[model samples]
Target: MDAPTNIQVEVSLGRKKTALLRSLKMPLTLSFPPSPPPTVRDVKRAIQKAFPKFYADRQKLSLPEAPKSLSDDSVLLFDAAGKVELVVGDLGPQISWRTVFIVEYAGPLLIHPLLYHLPTAFYRTEVQHSALQKSIYAMVLVHFIKRELETVFVHRFSHSTMPLFNIFKNSGHYWVLSGLLLAVDAYRPGYSQPVVAGTWRDGPLLQLGWAIWAYAELSNLIVHLNLRSLRPAGTTTRTVPVGYGFSAPFNLSFPNYFFETLAWGAVFLISASPAAALFIAVSFGQMLIWAQKKHRAYKKEFGDKYPRNRKAIVPYII
Candidate 1:
């Protein structure tokens, strides 16, 4: 058979930056320097190159790589003219339901440990990569749901006397997004197959907001800072898989990862039991507290570029 040409990709930076990457009435083909680039190998070869250490990992590798990633997996498609253009990771091959699981597991391995475990890797590696993990998490979480868990266990809208816990509102948004993806897959077996939902337009539209929020957090200040190292100026070069600030002792750290894990658990828990949903709210509280501090710091720094409309951890209110 001839080579398949149906491979598609959608690339965007964000709304304000959309024009930078989006194409109108055309597939999003990219150019290097001035000319269109060359074709490349498939996914298996790409994995071997980027992760020479993980030859075994590549043996039954289920994750997907961009079509072009196989060209030289170590280096993305950069033009010989020396002007960098884009990346396979940025405009990778389309993600599928099975591949989404691999992406989700990567979250716990790549994000949660770093978020709440290691000190050395957190500070040493760029926080942007760490923060991007959230984007990936949100992307993956958009794939699961339980009905009763969504409605019964947690309250979507209400006043929280605790500003720290108020961010559960955002969790609700994420949970809702997860629900939509679940609904889609639950009803439609394959992306090509048809499914039924009775006038269910509301869920997806609301979900877009949550996805945007997830993207926003993916680019936020906390995500920008790598917290892998916890040494003073003169302290020895000690490393831990993860570390928390002295103020944030190990006991305190669980609550953060717990918040993350529970956020996911809440999603799965929404239909099973309220206990998980309650934990979801609790985790929301911890995450909000974490974000509120930085939101305040930025407000103090910008003094003016900051908008009064800004809310720290949640979307609408501060």
Candidate 2:
């Protein structure tokens, strides 16, 4: 079979000011035929075809003045026009999504336990510890460990490579928040009290929180397993996930995100730090945005076959 004729593209590799190709005595500007109205991936492929040393997986293509790297690989080259001002560079190094998640989750799992048990020089005085604090710590550890395990065994990433810069960003987010939550709860004055001290009135709220957390964690796991089952090993085929086991019977949207939010809500109920609650709010907001996007994409793909009454991340309310 004859190969498809490639479209001509003029690509500038590496940043305008600091071109990596130029440093390596390679051409900064190269003209290659990719495809008509080439996507970012096409440009990368073109570069790799010409210069096999420059791997597409490590490249981070973006506009010169853009605040962040371009995430949309399907964007047409011609549509960029003046906006192109193409600034290409290595995103340090590429890493798999599984590695990223495992590493990110591991930071919190290890750091939290150390901070709780071992007193630092700054926090030399031991605050009165409570059963609730120990419970919360255990829950946090379990949550992150489960996440790491899921990344390894269950979750399937659509894209294999992530920008190396994301490792730092994600690590900072999880690490800082974990440290802050643990430190604030442990060392902060008047913050180490039990959420419910087995009192007749408020003790039930603590029990309810535990129940909700358990349910949410279990439901989230089931949803992940269902999603993983959709794409069998050695295949890229996508199938609509039917509601089953912990999923709402009539809903075809992101039920996992709903359960995830509920789990965090339960965590917030048990937490003494306002920061923890704030973090949950922010995480839920971000999850909702992604869930809504997923919902819309499903509707677009499935048309009338998609469920009509299901909300994005919530059952009846979004």
Candidate 3:
């Protein structure tokens, strides 16, 4: 079979012009106990109130061009009446880094509180194709927690009684990993006659340790990023880290906001992994030392330009 390509589109009917303007209209009838029939004006007002932006959509109505997709999936579009209109190939990226960022970073903060400490999966060959994939799941959970910290600094305070609801405030900014999964599925879609089953093929015990460590690193990310953003007031001296001009404060830099992201990401992979603990621990431990070294280098070079006593990873250690 020939490989699939990467450009797709989903076509739908343009927004309604008025309450009376429903496409592929279906009529529903019911007997009411002497209630007044609803008028068209009331319907119009309700529609406008619900979707203010769609009210003025005057774009030309036609099917977009079908292009090749990055992933090997057929495209399907639906209208209000549930009919496929235009089916294009990949308009969206086959693999998006932003979605990877959120799933890998911000995921852990939420996961840790909910799912005890250790990772959910064991060394199951059936559930996961390889230990490497389980590591990936843990890794995504780590990033979710790390990135979620932004909820505090970026979002202004609200006195909402529902904390769960607040998490949705800037949710549009999230990277939906499901898209990647769907794209991948499209590329080589699965199901053996629609059968789904998996099992473990024996493994080590330290996976739990790695899982715990993964979540801990996630916890650290949230604190660090939020802390990193809120620098001490009235201290404007260096553009980059104190000594280094543009290079990061640390050797391996991602976003300046999420300092310890890689460290946690490593721990997630190493968790429940057949890898040596000393190796992973040493890696995480060294990251701390490196961060402190960079911080110290910055402080010594710029003096008052940098804050006096800012610990890198641990509270009062470095």
Candidate 4:
């Protein structure tokens, strides 16, 4: 039998209506091509076309019975009568993931330099920071600047947007720990200074730490580029990252996380600040959880094709 040319979709608002607008009293009737099997995104686009005021990003489309909003890629299900019902929830204010990432990274990028230069802001007095303190401060600036650049040019998110309020939560995390906390600790009086006062002998060790930090930062960027390469432009395809990117001698499920932790660890080594250590510990815990989730997702998606030897967030260890 030939495929149906069009499927009529009945669209209405969900129970949890947005306060931004009153509930859409009249259900909308929209026609979609059946050959392509329209997705939630297509349905939302159709709705947007009909009601120009309702943009796709602010619309959360779902099935009539399902309380959860449908993903943009979800295929529409039509009954035998060639009719499908859809409910849209208003997301109210929404922000693109790209904007969220930029905002989140910008917090640290801006705060770090300010706290470092304004000694009185954090230290409460005019006090000289050790040479190592100055070096680590520079590293902090470089690291966040690189992150901002990557967020703008390199990274592609699977989801285009998120709720508006998440920007504050994410920004606070980076701004507080990695930026304000570490910078204050590093710039504090006498940090990284030798008790014996013998010409600040950590110069040699600081040089070594800087080298390691550079390597880790570069490796992290490579991993991000590799991950980006796995998914082509304008698509959200997940493929097994083999060889240098996600597999091989590293055998770490999330080498990016490992390299990021290593970079932060190098900062701690350079500054010898408790705040830096605390940041590393807290971030490692979070990265480990995310790595474990990603590892599980890989195994679940690829099954036996996934290497059993791969460990999450760590090399050769859990």
Tens digit of per-residue lDDT, candidate 3, span 1-318: 332232222233333333333432322221111123322222223333443432312112234343222121212333333332331111111223333333444533443333222223321112222443434445555545435545344322211122232234323223222223211221121211122223221234336545555555654454444444445433322233322212234322222323343444444333323222332354456566677676667667767865554555444444
lDDT of each: 0.33, 0.68, 0.35, 0.81
- Give the candidates in order of lDDT, highest first: 4, 2, 3, 1
Winner by TM-score? 4
lDDT of 1: 0.33
Give, for candidate 4, the lowest lDDT window spanning 10 residues: 192-201
Q: List the residue pairs that clash in candidate 4.
A: none
RMSD of each: 24.1, 6.0, 20.4, 2.6
Which stretches in model 1 have alpha-carbon errors above 4 Å?
1-272
Give the alpha carbon lDDT tens digit for every residue of 1-318 in model 4: 555668999987677666644645448898877878888889889877877777898888877777787888899888766789887778877789989888888877787777777878777777566668767878888888899899989998987888889998888888888877877767777663543135533558778898999999999999999888889999988888765636777887789899999999998876668888998998999999999998999999999988899998888887
lDDT of 1 by residue, 189-233 (tens): 221112212222223533553454444333321221223223333
lDDT of residue 206 for candidate 3 = 33
Ranking by TM-score: 4, 2, 3, 1
All candidates' TM-scores? 0.22, 0.73, 0.27, 0.89
> What TM-score does prediction 1 earn?
0.22
lDDT of 4: 0.81
Total colliding residue pairs, candidate 1: 15
